[model samples]
Target: MDKERLYDELRIFKDRHFLQQKLKSPLTVYVLLALSYLLITILFAVALSRVSVLSSQLNEMRKELKRNHSSEDFKLFPCGPEAREWEYFSGKCYYFSLRMTSWQRAKVLCEEKHSHLAIVNSHAKQNFIMYRTRDKRFWIGLSDQNAEGVWKWIDGSDSTTGFTYWKEGEPNDSNQNEDCAHVWTYGEWNDVHCTYECYYICEKPAPL
Candidate 1:
């Protein structure tokens, strides 16, 4: 009876040791898996941060490139003798001298000088020219003489849609006989008789 009792106690000890060993192995495996997951998560976060920084830099570079291209695209005209004393800006040249001439005569003169009538594209530009002229009236390159009341610019642009600075009650064909457009003392546009004389503005494409 004593031998049997000792044998049963030994078996019980062996079973308990086996269970402890099995539990230790599975616990170690779980710890290793958790550590691997933490490492992967850290690496993914770092990669995403780097990608975000690079994207922001790329966008800034694109905007800079666009600004440079815009500046490079415009070419200044009448660069040499014609506007020798005048300052050039944004591909256009200005002459501040108040030289008055008839519309047809002005057209002929500008053509001889390798230019055409000036076409104002913006209010700022128009104001700049108007201010420079010392409030004197000048002739722009728009006329309706051939068509009688249908005005067109020297560059073939339609004046009807582009007229932004018309003088009050202007282009009224005041005498019911005005067929030419001219700038006024107040930096506005008005219709005048074709035979009337006025100072003129001229334009030409910039040299390549």
Candidate 2:
């Protein structure tokens, strides 16, 4: 009877151990599934946050574009004798020359016409210049000739203190000689030698 009782106790312990092992596997699987769900939820939340921020930025950009396009300052006005040969915008007259010349000569020519080489200070003006100078390289009124890396507009204004739109990796002063600034047809600035010949744009204030 003692041997039979000992065998019954052994069977009970084996059944309990098997039950514990089965419970442990299911618990481990539940823990793993819970962690995976948590990770997926966090990732989805982050993605949603990024999408929201991007949507807001896109809306702001659209508003800005609309404002720029609808402003009367962006309109072209060619009125009176002073503006006959020039395109007027935002109280300024611009002359896009067809002849190519050295930067120095171009500056002198503009001055002779009672104007100066173009000094771009705003995006709207830059766009207008680009539209008028389509597919042509033109010299603007910017240079670092007086001091390397210290660009200044022809009006003696500091170029670093205001708006500037330089092409990527430009104004590199290639061969240690490039000092004059010119605009590409695509509306970005680059530095080249002042002696290099190119067409130019002139800017002057419109008469009140």
Candidate 3:
């Protein structure tokens, strides 16, 4: 009878220990799951923060790049001597008139613009003017209006001592009325009537 009682008590104690161990296991597992969730949330928040910082940095870099590009462009192309409708080349600024007018009117217009008619004194200047004039008959600064058979530049320089590209058999005083010299398409000079309408070129020294 005593032995039976002892065995019963031992079994009861064992069962109680096992139930306690099972309850403790479930609580530990729940704690572990909560810790894992907290860790994942922290990691996600850190990743989002990093992404936002990177985006802000990238935007700032783009703005800085644009500013630098604009500054460099300004440095490369500063204010030149040429104004609107003028082209700068070889220490001079030239204006090619789009409309045709009489040689005297063209000269006046150039003077009004603070310039003068084109005074080509070298082969290089003539070629440059011709290239721009193209096929158009553009009036230059050469003429014998002062004295027939005595050609002179607008600046009063003698034409014979400078440069002259007269076309073959040009300045022949055709009809006794051709006194003004104009450039032909082939970079040659021709004597045309001063009243004849033609495109013209203006020249001025480039500001230092």
Candidate 4:
């Protein structure tokens, strides 16, 4: 434990074979580390690019699948030749036929089947019916039978602002006797006495 002996031991420890092993050059080690880091960055960038491209392709494929499936679904429920046809877009069923009955009778028939006569709303819907019927005449729900000249749909909908595809000057109560409305050829509308029978169209909300 003398100072001279302690210094001699320290020197011996520093000069040992293990401690004398050649050390790595700091500059060379740093250069190798930098090169490895750059390689890793490049690899990561390539991997990210590939992943992005794959993700985009997957998204596009999903969209195409949805489009195809939706079209197929629509085709499964087509408008058939039944007295009532379903309108998928509106979730409603429509009946466009020529059965000629009084407005009250038509309403009663519709109610019995859990529906009411057709209520023409938009021009688009009227045109849609016309096209489906091949421009044939059908009765709508509108009528002024209660108080002549005050037309209203079965649902109490005011047809004043509604698109009236009426035949020109036809609802003039021609004989001052017309009390019912009916769709005519060319998608035009006309008024007739309720007693005069004509084909009618009925509409109902689709059952849930």
Candidate 5:
């Protein structure tokens, strides 16, 4: 009878220990699963935050490019910014001088400005020059500097086949003092003395 009671007590103790161990294992598993879930949630949230930030940066870059494109649209003129005050025509810039100087001095001034005297190569250009001069006279690029009767242009304009706006009975080289040419307000040209002081025009190619 004593042996039977000892066996029963041993069996009950063993069962109690097994129940405790089983309960502890389930609790540990639950804790590990909960921790894993929390870690996954945190990582997903971080990834979303990084994606949102990148999207915002991309949007800002697009806006900057749009602004730059808009600014470039305002610069439409073919001539450069330095020629804003000059007249732009046919890929050339014409500068009307406000000051007066002799023909030789005017040529020197135009050369110093990296340009040459205005050469009227076309009828449209001649009429444009005439309208711009108004009632004032301007010494043009034409001159007989090489020879007395051989009229030439400082800008190397070929007048043999080009148009001429010479006034009536002009270029007679009156009294041997008329070698340089000047344009009057009527668009007609007259040979004048080189020492005569007058307004002038300068011309140069416009920037592409």
Candidate 6:
């Protein structure tokens, strides 16, 4: 009887289980969205921080480059061995002839040296050449050899467009054959007969 009572006490009368609660609607989505948003925010902050660092480094490099090259001549002419026997200005090399010759002969001489007559394109170049001229007349490479009154450089650049330093009542093509351009004593320009003997200027490309 005691054994039967012990068995009855140890036996379970009904099946038993702990209940599990289901997550509520919308709460699951809210939690997932919060996690996703946090992950994306962290990634964006990392990318932005890296970009800022790179930008700062590039700016510093640019400043250093400018500082290093600051003393260098901004003129593209390298003024080195390859540009020997020439003077540099802006980005071109100029050669002033000590001898006087006809405009056509001057052009021939310049072409022989693999260059053309000086083509002044800027006020600075005009001033520089004038200072070197010392009040003497010099021939440039401008002409209307192709068409009357339609002036052009020997290199075929249109001269009607920019920075002309013509003298008063000049380039009148005085004899209807005045086609070549020359600089006067005070840096003014005039068109004269190609046969006129005058000092010439030559120009060529600067080095690489």
Give the TM-scores of the predictions, in the order they appear. 0.57, 0.61, 0.62, 0.57, 0.63, 0.60
Candidate 4 runs further than 4 Å off: 1-75, 78-89
lDDT of 1: 0.74
Off by more than 4 A, model 2:
1-79
RMSD of each: 13.1, 19.5, 13.1, 11.5, 10.2, 11.0
Backbone clashes for every candidate come to 1, 0, 0, 4, 0, 0
Candidate 1 clash figure, as a count: 1
In candidate 6 the C-alpha lDDT for residue 150 amounts to 91
By lDDT, is 1 or 2 better? Answer: 2
Model 4: per-residue lDDT, tens digit, 1-208? Answer: 6999999988898877444443366676788799999999999999999999999999999999987876665566533323325553366777655566777788788788777888878877777777766655566788887777888887887788776778887689878778888887787888887777777777876543
The stretch of ten residues in a row with the least summed lDDT in candidate 6 is 14-23
lDDT of each: 0.74, 0.87, 0.86, 0.75, 0.85, 0.84
Model number with the top lDDT: 2
lDDT preference between candidates 3 and 6, better one? 3
Between prediction 2 and prediction 6, the one with superior TM-score is: 2
Tens-digit per-residue lDDT, 163-192, candidate 1: 467788777786977877777876788888
Those runs of model 1 whose alpha carbons end farther than 4 Å from true positions after fitting are 1-78, 81-83, 96-98
| Candidate 3 C-alpha lDDT tens digits along 1-208 | 9999999999999999987887589787798789999999999999999999999999999999987876665344332423656776678889899899999999999999889999889888988887888768998888999899999999999998878899999889978979898998687899999999999999987654
Give the true-structure RMSD of model 3: 13.1
- Which scores higher on lDDT, 2 or 3? 2
For residues 1-208, what per-residue lDDT tens digits would candidate 5 score against the true structure? 9999999999999999987887689787798799999999999999999999999999999999986755564265445555566788777888899999999999999998788998887899988898899868898899888876777789665565678889899878886878888898597898888998889999988764
Model 6 lDDT per residue over 25-111, tens place? 467768878999999999999999999999999999999898556435334335544455677887788889989999999999999
